[model samples]
Target: MTGRRLTSLLAYVTTAATGASLLTGCGVLPGATGGSREPVTVMTWAPDQTRATNMPGMPAMAQAYARWVNSQGGLDGHELRVITCNEQNTSAGAADCARRAVRENAVAVVGSYSQNGRAFMAPLEAAGIPYIGGYGISEDEFTSPLSYPVNGGQASLIAGHGMQLAESCRKVSLVRPDTIAGDKLPGLLNSGLRKASHRSAIDIPALEDAAEYSQQADRARTKAGREDGCVTAVLGERTQTFFDSFRRLPTGAADGDAKGEEGGKDGKEPAVRISSVLGSVGQPVIDRTGGAHSPFEGAYVTGWYPEAADKSWAPMRKVIQEHAFADNRVDPADAGVQTTWIAYTVLKEVVEGLDQDTITAAKISHALDRGARIDTGGLTPTLRWKYEDLLGAPGFPRIVNHEVTFQVVRQGRLVAQKPGFVDVGETVLSAP
Candidate 1:
């Protein structure tokens, strides 16, 4: 038969197999094994060796989390079983990962990153598995009934970045990937800028996997530096490379302003300041690019969580030290790695909240649906999900954390620009 027809047939077969597994008392349904003290299994999937964003750290962190929890006698009394998948940055790859998660009888998929939300959400919903703490790359993450997104994803980041730029930047130029998923980014950012009555930013799309972004950088730099301008790039892993290209191009001294000895006797305004979100450009990149002298030295950044040096990360660092010490894949500062840590933190709370040794996918889903409040130490404001919790944002109905942390590169580190998170709930709700 046709490829589409074959996919449907395979899906039907998997559904049938899932039904059989549940009926055979395999602990796939709600409280399948009552107080049995069995293992609580979950899946974590992320792209690896892909043309764009690569999140190998997510799965590696999941495995490390499993080792850490299991060593401590697991979440509650059940062993934490983690099944990792490499999505390969493809829709088909994502679908395969979801099917594997269903077939393996995972209760939830936690702390993962994938741009192909539609491909994965269907299978997880079919099998009643909850998707917790997703990277928020796709729109379906906010709309899917089974998705419990911990952070605001790309939506909040772009919006917050715009607002952060409004007061200081006279002209803003956005550099983004030229992909279907990257299309919505420009509009989201414009919404925030419009809220401040600022003109919409210039949208510059470039090939996602291009080895060099020199041409795109040149165009962006010219437009962004026109008058107190800024260039913001959200091209995932390629963000740093894009800035590197921009930095190589010469930016000469200004001859217009000469005030005093302290204020640049003949100093001019910054040519074009660099900016990005957490996943695209962060501390790890800064450290590698010569720290304080990095291209992102004075860049503005937005993120879902606090800095890696924050004391809140100590617990996760301790776990990493004990279990993943030698594993180079686990970078405590990587956004995906930090996301996984938070997702597992939520899972641990959810499993323990059941107050029973036995657990299943249905049980977990229902509990979250019933408004379970989970506290992630102080990492995030206590996350409690309810129907009313939905912000009723245009397409993103399930976004609960409309807050984003404003950060800037200082002394080669990504430090908080403002003291706390900026609430962009109203800003996102007003997005076109």
Candidate 2:
């Protein structure tokens, strides 16, 4: 479809998808639920494939959290049973996961990642199971009243990149997939850049699943690193491959090298910087590339939460070490895994707040919908979702958290560049 047509379709979907939760009647509550002793069942899912952007660790993390929680005699005396699912990164698979959650009568779906929003969301919404802490890949996560997103998803990432680059870049280049979802990148990125009085980035669309992006990388590097230029890639898992190709090409004495427009009087040049969002670049990617020696060593990364190395994550790390020692499925630093941990934190708090009330999908959604404040141990500001929390951003009314953290890779670790959340709420709500 043409760009105009795709844009039009996205706009329509945003409108039709708008609305709060349906408050569907009770489907099935857990066995002996609210007895102050029954297990509170929940579902966690992600794509776990050898050849895709698999996040087997997400569900595994949920399992680990369950083990840790139950070992402590459960949350508020309620046993936690977490069911895992592999969405296979397909629409049909995502739908199946949702159906299983409904059939299993889960109280909530936590911290799962999937691009097939339409396939999965409708079933859960119909069943009244609140989707807490999704990775925000699909717009539906924000549009659906059932979805309680802990992060701003891609919308904030792209806009935050523009905000980050606007400060130092004379020009910017964005390398993205040549797909419908990707077509939204330029507009979102430009929203922040234009806000800063900077020119829009040059959009560079490339083959999503190609073997190598050498040509595209060359173009991006030449355009972005020319002087005070910057290039940021957001091609999901393929972003690493693009940058690998980007590294192999000799890009003019490296960035910040002498002889460029940003050259210091002492013969040191201020070359363009490279950047990406959380999923594409993280601790795992850095370690795989070469740690301090990795090409991403100096790269800027925007993320939904605090850095993995932050002291705030020590509790989560300790949980994984204590309970998930034998499980390679969970990575302590993977955003998918971290999100699962936070989602469970929210679940634990809400469940405990129930006091003696029976726990059901409807009850859970109602508590969150009516404004239940969840504290994430400084990982995020207190989270509450009332109508006032909504961003009113077209198609994404439920984005209560438009704040993204700026992170940088240092010596193989993801660390905070700025120690607090940067609000991109206006940037996103104002996007073209």
Candidate 3:
């Protein structure tokens, strides 16, 4: 089919998909319901069933949030309508989702995930629909004037990851995807390492969805010094595969484990420590691999939010338990789910503060751009989109919350290594 035909067909499918929600008390019914405020419609898209990183949970969480909020008479009396799409992890797919959002007259694209930032952002920009609370994997999420990011994106996480490993690892090897987004990882990471006067890491680029990484693993292991060295992989879903290959190596066993702090079993060559960012590795991955016996046991993790077990997540946990009890996709521990929850939180704040009879894309963006402050119930520092609040970092000027948390896997559970958030705004600014 031609591009226009494909877009038209996608719009039809997207609209049709939401029809089932009406029976579940979560569908959009144009105009006011029972004299309540006008309903606010939004879209949430993420890659599902993809070869690369798939975040079905992000859209799932958005739907769950809509159900929960609508159950409570909606957000400040305005019924919340959520339209979900599967971006399919392709540029065309991402663009399709954005075009559907426009066709559906969505006020904003909230709590969505997509690596094809350029593909999606253009359509949203042309429609004047604000891109809110995107999973910050692509640089476009940080640069688009219409995009309002809830987290500091990969730039903060990688930079913070570098800082997290600086004092511990003697040498670092970064195994990242060889893509436009992946190209920036080294500079961001190096900036953080340089703060501690540590040397630059060995940059090893690999396919994002490679079936195995024995070669890259071997190279990373060799580059990491024999003793007190670390290898950090940020290859999304393939991170597990990389580590699986990594451990099969003669020295991969007990990697990042304290048993090898001094040296390997032979007490001569130490196993390299392993690490990754939140999306690449999380509680779900650990639980699946074998909790308490998982390969991630002693691995370092950097994230944009507090640990999943933190008390701050109680509200989100409650929503998931009550409204999303049967939805296994909405894992409270998953960062995508957490981001969606936070994104909806921002939306709620924006909607309630408006107190308007009807909400629109222009109105939502105007409220945010005019210095609307959002309190995520302590999930993140107060988020505002004012020009003065930005980081002014090269290629990422929209980063306002440049804070990251340091986490470590202890007994197969990710826990905070250091209390409180670490400010990486300066580190992002100093990147090459």
Candidate 4:
């Protein structure tokens, strides 16, 4: 459909959607009986059936939060009804879902899967709906007032972790897929490394396929001097290719034999440490590197959510264990589940803080600008909203400054090298 026509249709739908609330001066309908209440609907991209099972622990997490809100009497007796639809991981599908959400009079949206959330940004904004959750990394969508990013963007996370790496390593190499997420790594790391007050040599290869990463890894290993210099590697991938490539590379005595002993022909071996930003394939990376063939031994990774063992995340853990855990479905460690919890909590906060009985898109937007910090005990960083500065934006992106600290597996289990928490510092991007 044409943009103008689509815009007009959306406006009409939005009007119809909120007509009853407008007339009643509240979400409830007129002449409603005792205990009559308007249901606060939360829309997400995951289809109801699929989300309940496949997408990590989010369904349980969401349901747990819903139950918690309900137990607290649910936003002044208005019960929250979560309505999920599958965006099918496509922009068009996500936009269609957004339209449906407005048509259903959803107060806000949460849990958009990956770029699908970014795709729905325009429509959600046009429909005057607000959203929370992290998926979109693009700057344009993140800086907008209508959309609040709870999990933080990938680019920003990379920058933060890169800064941490620069403090200990002198040479850095990035191995990533050829997707949009992969493409943004070099620029993001370069900017991040500079801010950390260190200069490190960087290597980024254009990997069209995961198998092709072997060539890139080989080059990175050589440039990093095998095991002598303080070299760090940053890898990004959504497929098993990254893990496979890294595992295939020679390591330990085998590596020494293939490339000659330390200082035999190529001089001293380089002290190479590998690290990765959170990707869709993090589990595989952890699993592969934890085995005997582990290539990521001694590596560090940055992640959005805290692991289950993080002591700081005790509160969130209690909630998840008591309410979210059911059967074997919910895994709180999954980034998506943690993100959903944060988004739901933020939405609840905004709704409860409203002074007026009725809620409007404008009002919700305003509450977010006031910059509320949500402390869910440290499973994630304290989430805060920053107002728009002189840049003429509504606000700085909503940030959950949590970065996970993990050691690459040399043996079977993961070794904790540092405390895992969100990093909430302002990321200053600069020239590499």
| Highest TM-score against the true fold, candidate | 3
Candidate 1 lDDT by residue in tens digits, 1-432? 999999999999999998777754543233334335877889999999888889999999999998888766678867788999999989999999999999999999999999899999999999989999999998889999899989888999899888888867888889998987789889889988887899999999998777888888777877775567788999999887787777665544242121111112143335566788999987888888888766677778889888888999999999999999798889999898998998899899888899776789999989988998888877777786789887778778898888888898887889998887789888888888
Stretches of candidate 3 off by over 4 Å are 1-33, 252-270
Q: Each candidate's lDDT (Cα)?
A: 0.84, 0.82, 0.90, 0.56
The stretch of ten residues in a row with the least summed lDDT in candidate 4 is 388-397
* CA RMSD of each candidate after superposition: 11.6, 15.7, 9.9, 11.8
Error of 2 at 184 (Å): 1.6
The TM-score values for the models, in the order shown, are 0.88, 0.86, 0.90, 0.72
Q: Please give the TM-score that candidate 3 achieves against the real structure.
A: 0.90
Tens digit of per-residue lDDT, candidate 4, span 163-222: 657766666766544556556667667666777666655555554433436666666555
lDDT of 3 by residue, 1-432 (tens): 999999999999988876655533554333335544677899999999989999999999999899889878787778888999999999999999999999999999999999999999999999999999999988899999999999999999999999999979999999999999999999999999999999999999999999999889878887886678899999998999998887777634434333322233554434678899999999999999888777777889999999999999999999999999799999999999999999999999999899887899999999999999999987899999999999989999999999999999987899999999999999999998
Per-residue CA lDDT of candidate 2, range 1-432, in tens?
999999999998876655211211121123323343556889999988735477888999998998888777677767777898999988899999999999998999998999889999999989989999998888899999899998788998888878987887888889998876788889999998998999989899987777898888777867775577787888888888888787666634544332222122353333656888998788888888778667777678889888887788899999999999789878888988988888889899988888644578888889898999999997877888899988888867888888889888766678888888899999998898
Q: Which clashing pairs does model 1 show?
A: none
Which segments of model 1 are wrong by more than 4 Å? 1-35, 250-269
Q: Which stretches of candidate 2 lie over 4 Å from their true place?
A: 1-36, 250-270
Better of 1 and 3 by lDDT: 3
